[model samples]
Target: MKKILFIDRDGTLIQEPDKEIPQVDSLEEMVFLPWVISSLNMFIKKWYKLIIVTNQDWLWTELNPRENYTNINNKMFEIFAWEGVTFSHIFECPHFESDNCKCRKPKVWILWDFLSENDIDYKNSYMVWDRDTDSEFAKNIWVWFYKVIYWDDKHNWWNILEFVAG
Candidate 1:
């Protein structure tokens, strides 16, 4: 069975833009969080399959153009590749909160196919994210949850490394 690390993109892997609805609209707005690359490298070295699970609201809509999203996403992948950190899969929900889509975070509908196909070690697997919905998602999937407080100076995102080390 494979131990997977389900990660969130915005605010967790990258610094979320401070807006009413925080989203990385363009390449210029994309900024990776501190210690993200190194911590991900550690996870990869520990033999964890990295999976990105994120909610991208208004995607492909006029509000959030698909081309813009693709450009920004591709750049993020390129940077991660340069750092030797690669994601096994990326799952995104492009529905708004009002849509109440089954694929949204806290719902496992989008992951059902992957869950059925893979021999996952849920006991050792973890969900690392930055929101309450993400915590609920971990509970919904019956996996360990690690909440990342991006602005916490004391942690500075080092707790994840410590957790993985232990």
Candidate 2:
């Protein structure tokens, strides 16, 4: 069985813009957090498969068009590739909170297939993210959870390494 690190995208992997609703709508808004690359590299060195599980609200709507999202997302992947960091899979829920989608965060419906097919080491696996919903997601999936404070300069995003090392 393989150990995995289920990470969030905005606010966790990259800097989430200070908007009414945080979303990486454009390339300029997709700034990466400090020490993120190194921390993720450390997890990789520990033989953990990195997977991105995120909730992107109103993704296909006119407010957050699909084309704009694709451009920024592609750029983020490109940058990560340049840094030698690659994710095993990226599962996204593009639905509004009112939509009550089964794939949204805190719900394991979307991951049911992946979980059944793959041999995952649940004990060693973890969900690293910056939201309460993410914590709930970890609980739903029966994996350990690590809450990361994105705005805290003290942590500086390097605290994630503690999970891999200790």
Candidate 3:
């Protein structure tokens, strides 16, 4: 079987833009982008593992980092419970952009780690996100298997969800 798909939550699946997005440990702050519910539902039926890959610079910069993490986690559980979307994993990069860590997207370490742990097939796996940085990150790590899908109408990012579901 092909490996499961990895996804980005902010902007791509939801609209919590980089600046406004909290730690994302909670559901209230984790709002979905338009068509996210339906689009992801389709992928579920296709038997793909819908994992959410995110960058959480908020945790590192929050006024009270530990408390911020606590609140965010509560919100995330609540929101997911309501939305009925169970993620295989929620990998986050809590470091600032300057941290220059390899776990960040475009870097393959995390996804590669996920695949290694689960024995997933990279050849059959794919990634979807809505930001230039994320696209660049996934591409840097996964290379040809990564695809950037436009969330709305712009071609600036290609919509791999549409292509795969169709």
Cα-based TM-score, every candidate: 0.95, 0.94, 0.72
Judged by whole-model lDDT over C-alpha atoms, candidate 3 comes out at 0.61
Model 3, span 10-30: residue lDDT tens: 556655534544434444556
Alpha carbon lDDT at 1, candidate 2: 94
Q: Give per-residue CA lDDT, model 2, range 52-95, as digits (tens).
A: 99888889999889899889989998888888889999999999
- The parts of candidate 2 lying over 4 Å away from their true place are 153-156
* TM-score of structure candidate 3: 0.72
Every candidate's lDDT: 0.88, 0.87, 0.61
Q: Kindly state the number of residue pairs that clash in model 3.
A: 13
Which residue segments of model 1 deviate by more than 4 Å? 154-156
Worst 10 residues of 1 by lDDT: 153-162
Sorted by lDDT (best first), the order is 1, 2, 3
TM-score of 1: 0.95
* Candidate number that wins on TM-score, 1 or 2: 1
State in Å the error of residue 162, model 3: 2.9
Question: Which prediction has more favorable TM-score, 2 or 3?
Answer: 2
